[model samples]
Target: MSFIESHLGDARQRRRLITGIRESLRELGLHLSLLNRQVSSRLELKDIDVDCLDLIDRHGPISPSALARSAGLHPATLTGILDRLERGGWVARERDPSDRRAVLVQALRTRNSELYGLYAGMSTSMNQICDGYSDAELQVIADFLTRSAQAGRAAADDLTSG
Candidate 1:
């Protein structure tokens, strides 16, 4: 039998690897959440604000309505959140040139760099570790991360749909 066929027959081996990956991903996610909370505390912001900030960082120059939809937040809640963020100088609302009726919320890039500084050591270490992988292996790792995030979002949607 080929190596692929042999591995396919070994369900226990696959299960072990899957279990290990799942547990590690869970722990890593918790640790990152804790780290984000730490940064939020240092910035005198709440966990929800940190979450919204991350969303803005990922999807900013984004409309508040779009952000609310992406984040599953109500308009009123998002308004209060955006107000605090703007008042704190963490974000800015700008006229959307394409849509005269809309204002886009954008991350204050320079202000965000201060938060990134808190994660510099972790970022450097992760980059060094990623560097150990070959190009193909890194591609596989990237694919796994992308799929994992998709799965996570789908699962969250499932849980909240009811």
Candidate 2:
């Protein structure tokens, strides 16, 4: 059975599990956002700059439209972020090889070692934490986090639409 499917809990059990998960996710988000803000400030960048640059690093050679959608920024806002990053030598905007009309943004990896180092400590700690979990347990954790993020996004969309 799939990870989620294997949890054949009753309704109350499921509800309790979901409540705990949501609380944990919220706390996690809050803590990470705080940390990110601190790091971004130290790097002399606005929070959105770090956010956009991180997105580009994760999905570089990525089209502006997709980045805008993923970042939840308006296209004009994304263009401004791209302009700032390009000017700072943090990112590069290039023409899409497959689509001349499209612009792709990529992180200038060599220019951002300090940014990467700032997260290394936390990443290492998380890796050590995960080392305590067995493969199946890790799979369950991964699946739960993934579903929780999707649910959170869906809820946010619902709120914005109404």
Largest TM-score belongs to which candidate? 1
**Mind giving the per-residue lDDT tens digits that candidate 1 earns over 111-138?**
8678889888889999999989999999
Model 2 misplacement above 4 A: 1-17, 159-162
* Poorly placed runs, candidate 1 (over 4 Å): 1-9
Q: After the best TM-score superposition of candidate 2, give how far the Cα of residue 130 lies from its true spot, in angstroms.
A: 0.4
Tell me the RMSD of model 1 versus the true structure: 2.9
Clashing residue pair totals per candidate (backbone < 3 A): 0, 0
TM-score of each: 0.89, 0.83
